[model samples]
Target: MTLLLPPTSEVPVPKFNMADLTARLLAPGKPQEAQQQSSPALNPPDAPEAHEEVRERRRAYQRPAGHPSRQERAQARALAQQYRDYAEAWYQALRAWDMREVKIPYSFHYEPGESDLDFLTLGSNVRTPTRYLQTPAGEFTEGEVGVVITTMSRAPLVEQMQLGKMLDKLRHTPDTTPVSLLREDGRWHQNRERVARYAVAVLTLAVQLRDEGAEGPLRYAKAVLAGAH
Candidate 1:
């Protein structure tokens, strides 16, 4: 029986030129482009250092200092704590009632520290949910009244001056014009008035506790307004 056998001789392949192969592979269609050869003698070593300096300057410009002063940061933290306390008080007051009675949908807070105020606002136009037992007849409302706190300096001169200007406006016109006297004049005067009212309430409560022997009544009122705790 005869069997088919394969040839023993190897087929010779053509050796290609390195430059022609490189031109075919790397520099396909482009004509004789100059190769990017590096020269350490001609280039300055400080080029990288100059580039790094430019990059660092750009980063410095992009990012700024977080807090200018430690004292200012501490004051901000204290103010934030006060705001939390104020919010807790307001929330306690609101949650005292059944959800059916006061369905507070949207409440907003603004820190007007520069304007010497912080505000707790209720959007509803009805009577304020807060009931003042001392409120005269026909003065009760379920809509708007919340509280504002004046974070102004605790100096009598500054307080009196600011309050005096506000009082003069209140006494003279008896109109709620939403304007401020500050150079910045940031917030509406109505908000400032609310904060002033809270300050008055604080003073009134203090005075009553001191002389009128009304500590029990004040406690009861606060309990009623701010729920259990």
Candidate 2:
């Protein structure tokens, strides 16, 4: 039986190739490529596209320091209540929005020579509807000396400034334009940013009114962000 004995001497260690080891460690691989691909490029703030974005452009209103005065707070509360009223009115107006459709009535003088049943070709341009009022005897009040004429140009349908137009204008309106002047009639004055805020208030309130129970919360959009188009 042959027995193998360990040599009483130091074993020679193989030298490592540092360059090769480094090449392997720093080598470009699928993971590197994947990471590079996943990384997003930073956008320049001064880019032309960035400038095109319409933001919540508003004016700075001066206010007293730290805590607002009681009178100011009361005024703020009043403004809030006023906005709520405007929102309800705007919602109702939107619900009833429709193109103007007016009608008019005309009277004809019966001639003895003409048959009772005759072709009545009535075609005229009128924007309001008109109906004749007759007495119990099925006749218009006799002895009517004057013609009570009434004319409507559909202007009554929109007695307020165009809200839809304002909505659009606010998106691209200049800083000087006042949109904060939201009136009880669902119209607004200049101030584009404030107007945008008002619109947001209305929409937010409207969504609430519908009781959709939308999780999270719907935010009001800025007028400047709401493009004129």
Candidate 3:
């Protein structure tokens, strides 16, 4: 019998260039004004030049070579934690036992916004095809706010229609929507096995979240948990 192997280890992530944000916020024009203020004695002299020097200095301070300050580090930690939470939540939904027989070869990520749904592919067992879902100047499904799951491959017409209907119901209903994905042919079907698996995955995630909340993170941990809830 052949033994199954674990998934390959993900690559190392690069540190975020926090300086990019700081630079944008501290752009040149404003710095020049501040620099002119520094030397009131110089007659309407080169305020722009002064601003340039000030901006340069500000840039240097914003991104020092040494380790980040405590506050900076804390912000980084918070962002890191959010990434972790998102991953955990998705994984919980994906690994439900009910969906075991169904192929879930593709991995997907979504960010819900006021007007559009942004999709990100997280490298699935299926072919890598990334796409974005947009209203596209009012073709259809515009102004109607809810989640829409699109597959790289087409699903059965009936199952596709059912998915749309169920999604509408869930949107109107107070509870979070439950959707199931079949790996083979990348279909979105409402089969009992698929639904059960999806439900179990989400429920497990919610339970895990509650458990994490219960375990205190000291003062900082408490603050993080509070923010999450």
Candidate 4:
């Protein structure tokens, strides 16, 4: 028996020219052209204009001749006012705490006489002077002295000014200053317990301010108390 085969339709064959392929492969521009066609351009038609708009916006936001813009000025004023509020709050807290100075005897070895020649001839001797502090808690320990002195010394300028004002208001003598105390060679150290107590007191004040709807004072109190640790 003979088997019959099905008739097939004509199919077009794709023909590749070796010379054209070789030319395309050799031509550097061909790959770039094909890439340009295959992938979209890095920048669209409106890219230049968009970039210009962004640049213009940046320029608009930039300060002129180191002078801040109105918005920036407003922001700075707000920040300064905020710090002022913090200073005021700290002052009030200190006042409320009623820190009283107590006189204590401080003995130190010092070179007697003003001149170095006198020091060389006379030698150093122990001198006892009356010292004063709000508390005598950490008067002998180096660690506490370092921590308290360092913390107080590193206080922000605004806070330092407030402290100076507080000192003056409280009629505290120069010898009662933290630096002076620190220079006394273990005469005094800031009390960590006192600091922690003050922090808690400030936190309580912050809560009270919040309850009283005093947002500014509350925020200031919170900010001031943040350095307690």
Q: Name the lDDT value of residue 57 in candidate 4.
A: 37
How would you encode candidate 3's per-residue C-alpha lDDT over 1-229 as one tens digit per residue? 9985433222112233555434534666676654433333332224568545545444544464465767889987776454334333343333321121223356665655634433354354475433321221111221222223322012367545454454344334425544323323333233534343333333222333343431322233224334443
Clash pairs, candidate 4, are none
Q: State the local distance difference test value for candidate 3.
A: 0.38
In model 4, state the lDDT of residue 205.
33
Clashing pairs in 3: 32-51, 103-183
Q: How close is every model to the real structure, measured as TM-score?
A: 0.19, 0.23, 0.21, 0.23
Question: What is the C-alpha local distance difference test score of each model?
Answer: 0.34, 0.35, 0.38, 0.39
Model 1 alpha-carbon drift over 4 Å, by segment: 1-66, 98-140, 143-229
TM-score (C-alpha, index-matched) for candidate 3: 0.21
Candidate 2 Cα errors over 4 Å, as ranges: 1-66, 98-101, 105-229
- Model 3 misses residue 41 by how many Å? 17
Best by TM-score: 4
Q: For model 4, how does the per-residue alpha-carbon lDDT over 98-202 read when each residue is reduced to its tens digit?
A: 333444443445466655554443423434333322221212223332234344434676654443343443233433432211112321125533332333333
Error of 1 at 178 (Å): 36
Worst 10 residues of 3 by lDDT: 133-142
TM-score of 4: 0.23
For each candidate, C-alpha RMSD in Å?
Answer: 27.2, 23.7, 27.1, 22.5
Candidate 2 lDDT over 15-118, as tens digits, reads: 34444334434557765542322221222124444323211000001121234656788986676545444443443333322223336555444565666535
Please list the residue runs of candidate 4 whose C-alpha ends up more than 4 Å from where it truly belongs after superposition. Answer: 1-63, 98-229
lDDT of 1 by residue, 1-229 (tens): 9974333222112233344344333644543321211111122234567445444433432333342355777886665444333322322222232122433345555755646433345353334344331121112223222211122222256643453344333323434522222113322123434543433333232332242322333343344334322
Report the CA-based lDDT of candidate 4 relative to the real structure: 0.39
